[model samples]
Target: MVIPKMAQMVRCRIGYFTLKCSNRVVPRVFLPLKYQRLCFHTSWLLNVRGKEVLMPSLSPTMEAGTIVKWLKKEGEKIEPGDAIADIQTDKAVITMEYDDEGILAKIIIQEGAKDIKVGQLIALTVEPDEDWKSVELPSSTSIPSAASVSVSSESTESATPPPGQQNLAMPALSPTMTSGTIVKWLKKEGDEIEPGDAIADIQTDKAVMTFEIDDEGVLAKIISSEGSQVEVGQLIAIIVEKGMDWKNIVLPTTTAPVKSSAPAPSVSKPAATAAPAGLKPPSSGQVYGLAVKRLLEEYGLSSGQIKGTGRVNRLLKSDVLSYIQTNNVQKVKLEAVSPKTTKADAASRISAAAGKPSSYEDIPVSNIRAVIAKRLGESKSTIPHSYSTIDVKLDKLIDIRKKLKVENIKVSVNDFITKAVAHALLECPDINTLYQNGQIIRIPRVDISIAVATPTGLITPIVFDTVSKSLPEISETIKELAYKAKEGKLKPQEFQGGTFTISNLGMFGIKEFSAIINPPQTAILAVGSGREELDSSISPITRMTVTLSYDRRAISEDMAADFLAVLRAMLEEPTFLAVKRARNFMNQVE
Candidate 1:
């Protein structure tokens, strides 16, 4: 058949048939005959002399990303699988790779630029011999800017406000929350709700927080779906005033409401299109990406051999680097390396010629462990830490615990120690200060962080206003906090912003171990188990060693010593604690 002028045609011959295409590009053309199973492949390769490295979609819901760092600079010769840059998505910082081997000709976006949209040109790569200066970039109409993408993403819903309706928009739960996921809706449609009612539970970037309402109304309609991510200031639900015609009022079809500063009533629209299937995680035993697979092959390793630390146990480039550094393995030809060369074998071989397989397994660092490593590294490298240890007689505190137990009130030695530390902080306010922004901030209330060990890692839960709370109150609070912490349910406010931290390894029978100072806080006290010793009067005495790690920038050695001395006296003489309690009791009675 003849082709139209608007259509482009190409003809190819195979055996006795002629295959023709009108306008569409076909991969393989077939004939309608007895030999219909026979097909001919087409040679229609588009000329791709250069390629634009667009901002990649790192996560399923990642509309835009921030350039954390550039791994390859301009004029660098990059291979097909080389990492070009690191993109900071909503979930994590992932390395972006170059698909074609070329010379990085231009860097269009600088580092630290936020909200760069996917498919926006971030860099240009050209053949080694091609002059990139004459390359014509795509027009702005073809590829929208990052700002346009951001605006489009923000205004996915309708902008107009519904008549006479109250919109309950998603609030910025935390200072860092730009978007939040709806965990669950506490109040459903047609439910009568009053002021101070918790409408929903929102999972922000930091923690899950309750969304409370301040207006009295009937929950008319739910806008956003549960588990749907909604931007801050976007309408999530609608409420009607109590006196309005509740049953007869016709609700508008759900249209996603645009983000607004005020409570602009609007309907919800259909959710955004789901991300492509390529964004889904790989199946079990499969490598994460081409770059990761190449790196594994370069080192003659299998995907199952290296531990993955990425989300859902996906192996990342960082995990490979960590493995290489930890094992100190040299990259060799894949054919030269033995197939049975495990991580332990590599470590043992690096340490000594006699390959006594290293008795260690490579454990991928968890998210909490990685954060701990980074924060502790920063603290140790930047802050000047000075430690001092003091041994105090714990006989009085032990006797007090025994007496309290007999009164049907259970108390531990650590309880008295925490009380003593709080009292000493009150006496010496200088120790209760934080070195921040070139100033020593003296906290009015003594908020103490108690280190609790969980299965994942060590977490410190804070007890606020410790100086004012009674010993029993403090003991009960610590128990509650510890339980929540071990269950991984402690809120951000509970674990963050402490004036002091106490790490008691006494239960583990550890003796006098100094701890790294938790940042923003000047000092941390390390407590050891009590030991029995003979006193000068030949009587048995119980003593414990306490080591204080202080930031020299915030407090001097003399100040830290004086604070420890006061703490020692408070624990040694139980009378001070008794007198303080009696005075408070008498005031209450009066």
Candidate 2:
């Protein structure tokens, strides 16, 4: 006998029966002569029904994703490598591919559905011959337990009711924060929270920062415990609407806390572990690991003397180096104890005899300041710098600027200087090269970095292809970039990598100053304020002193001098700035 088709039937067992009493077939006893078991696996039953396509974890730290767009529509044929949708994770928007070849039966979550948890049903796929209407979708409750469905750790932790539930996830504080450690919770469970309230202090890879809540609600539950390292976008707490009864709200079962990509030491544990035989751990307060400890020992440094920037005030290699650098500490070789001293000791003795400060306040460095310190320090120490100064008569340029102002075409002296410098770089290509890896890299394009001072620190936003942009265009671009720089909205590409740098202190009434070369660029020009002076003929002229600080490795003194001479000539002529069009200016410069 044939059995009726049942979709739920997973397995079937066949047995043989023999009857002995019945005369019709002479079957007396029922016995199992042979047995056959039919096993139906989900992978083998692919052609029979549609499979639910769950949201995939595109990134290691991605807990939920926003559907940016759908590439394929319902009933569309999909191949294994076809892109089905674009998912926006915490870090970036990435394309999602269809791993199984089938027809796109349905899209459960439409485009722009944000914060959709991983392993949640996103779409459905059915075999080409299978009827899409007849396919049954697994219930939301049973979706996680489906044979083909596998829940991610993030999904398991965030499987809460759709409405009236909000997840407070660990945010990506910076571009590099893969995970963050909970420093401390400001508000406990059942506390009413307002927008912009500091919920917790999180220690990221860079620094410890306060995590603020953007929504006004009651923090109903804290999912991740204090001191736990949680991945970016991982659920850290639960927040309910302000009027809702938080205690009555059913919380999802909390999963194990997500581990950070970076190994964070537990605060309660001992900072230093037992060293190998014949090696002793440093007597510092807390040294992070063997590498740091080894470096400290090698440098004959004490961890306590260096500020700890890692989690739980642990010493990091970078912190050690920064401390050593800031303190001007040097590694001294100890020989047999004799009263004989070296040059360094003599220098130290002279410095001690000169003066000794009783005390001073130690200020913690900001992120931008620290970066500036490190880069400037490195540039000053490594690069052999040479300076060239020229006092150019800027009376013509000043008159041109005044005439432009009358025409409502506002252009600053710096804009004219930038244009002239771009032209000068075209004429003197040797000054446009970069010295990197002991090789002179010829940069074909003239991308000039204009220094903008922000509240945090100094940043240089690049004016790309400066040789091709007109003065007014450069002026507008500089204004926009300066605004963005002050607001800290400048992207990495906007502020990084340039063939040359220009820093103008003219607005602050500064006369002449040398600027440190922003490597790997060959040179930087420092512009001072234009001061009125009388020539030998008693004619009034505005004179501005410009200093060129160049990397001696990439550019010779003569090459730098020629570039500045051309720049001064162009500025002094000032008619070159009249040609507002780049092509006309190029022709004029040539």
Candidate 3:
């Protein structure tokens, strides 16, 4: 390892360094001399310290990203694992966590800074409260202006430049979306925008949809031209200090458009398949762009009549077509609303009818709604699902929860029910199998996912080794995953790989409802609100009802009913579940 004495001229470039294992050495002639000729070694060593924060390898395809905002401001103290910035990657705006504790001393690449290659330094961070001058900064390639990072100590510091002045890149809206076409600008440069304000219309391979601001900011600059095909993470616009210089902001040419040969139908003509009865149809004028409109036309469906169900009502042409095939119903002609209005006219009319178009009204799909749509869509199309619901008097389970609550256990009614189901799974092992890879994959362990509803979406985190975990452990896991899911921080693995799922909305006072089975899992249990009412004896009391939606493919009606019967019995006798714990809970009891 060699250290450069000259700090100002030292060029720090990734890949220049090679790591040689001192434990073993090969002959000089046999070794690659060129690889050994460069800088320091080690695969994970970050060479440059006080400089820009380069793009991380989030996925295989991502090469670079524009800094959307620095979550931590210059001079602000940050600990390792603290998110320092939010980067607009090709996929989404992901939080960039720093691994070292420091104060953000300088910003080599300012917020909205664009077109940075991977491993390029974007900021300078030094040990907290350390002298900035003592820090070693490699000063090769492009040196950012020192003035760019200076901030008045009294000024309210922000991670990014003032809203409207910070540049944001287009996001990869979907797993398959490689690029986006800017359909139109909803807000012009200099327009004031609040969180949720429509900034622009972007057309992805799937749909034409509007993107909104996550935080309140102003529209400062338009980077790529309207209609340009922008790759995910490519700067599309800039919002920063009102008069910040953008001359040094370098953006790579938008990547080549991802082309597809699929033919889109004409906007004027609806596609052959139509929306279901009572659903409104999308008109040619309402079609935002060519790709989405063509796909909609081919399917002959209306956007309004069909629920978008995406994060935003960003419907791709595929969604419309998929809705048509799944519902298997023809479109119903919508009643004309007076003289029809053109798309542009409707925008103006809505703007006039409502107060500010900037404050436009749109109902975004909560994370729950999006997940529900995806799961239900898959279940309906892919899984042959038939539901079986049995009403179990929850008097015993409620009493058990009450006793547990008094003991400071605080187990929810859902918790008690989940334990009962786990016990049942142990007895009826076949009911716990999942259909995958065109065969029934019997999971050896019982992993149950509890559906928790948060404002953002419905997420089900797993109760690991459900058969083995105690009631309290399962309840604790449920609470933790539920919180993470509501916060949108749940990793894919957390919600994945379940043999069965339980969806309970009893707390919300919902009663006796059927839930769509979450795919790959053979069954889902929808637990509804318990009610206090008179029973067959005409005595008033509180009780709950439950429903089970099962995959008819792997489980027969008789087997499903038997599983519920076991669950009902276990719930009725709390000791039945206690005995389940005695069995080591490693495998299903049955």
Q: Top model by TM-score, which number?
A: 2
Native-to-model Cα distance after best TM-score fit, residue 204 in candidate 1, in Å: 4.7
TM-score, model 3 to reference: 0.45
Indicate which candidate wins on lDDT.
Answer: 2
Return the candidate ranking by TM-score, descending. Answer: 2, 1, 3
Positional deviation of 61 in candidate 1, in angstroms? Answer: 36
* TM-scores for every predicted model: 0.48, 0.49, 0.45
- Give the least accurate 10-residue stretch of model 3, judged by summed lDDT: 149-158
Off by over 4 Å in 3: 1-250, 255-360, 364-371, 533-542, 576-590
State each candidate's clash count.
6, 6, 35
Per-residue lDDT, model 3, residue 376, is 73
Model 2: residues >4 Å from true position, as ranges?
A: 1-364, 581-590
How do the residues 1-590 of candidate 3 rate in per-residue lDDT, one tens digit apiece? 23333222222343343333454442222224454334432212333245345567653334566576778776788887999887765435678898878778777676654445567777777655455444445547454321222211111121444323454767644333446678789988677777778888776543455677777656766766777766555556766543445343333332212343343333544444555433446443332234445444444455665554332234444455556555553333333322566676678777878876643556855324554676679788888778777767767566656555555666677777888888789888887887765777676778788877656556567887887778777778888887776665565446545778888888887888888887667888888887878888998766677788888888999998899888877776665554433333323323
**Whole-model Cα lDDT of every candidate shown, in order:** 0.68, 0.70, 0.61
Residue 157 lDDT in model 3?
Answer: 20
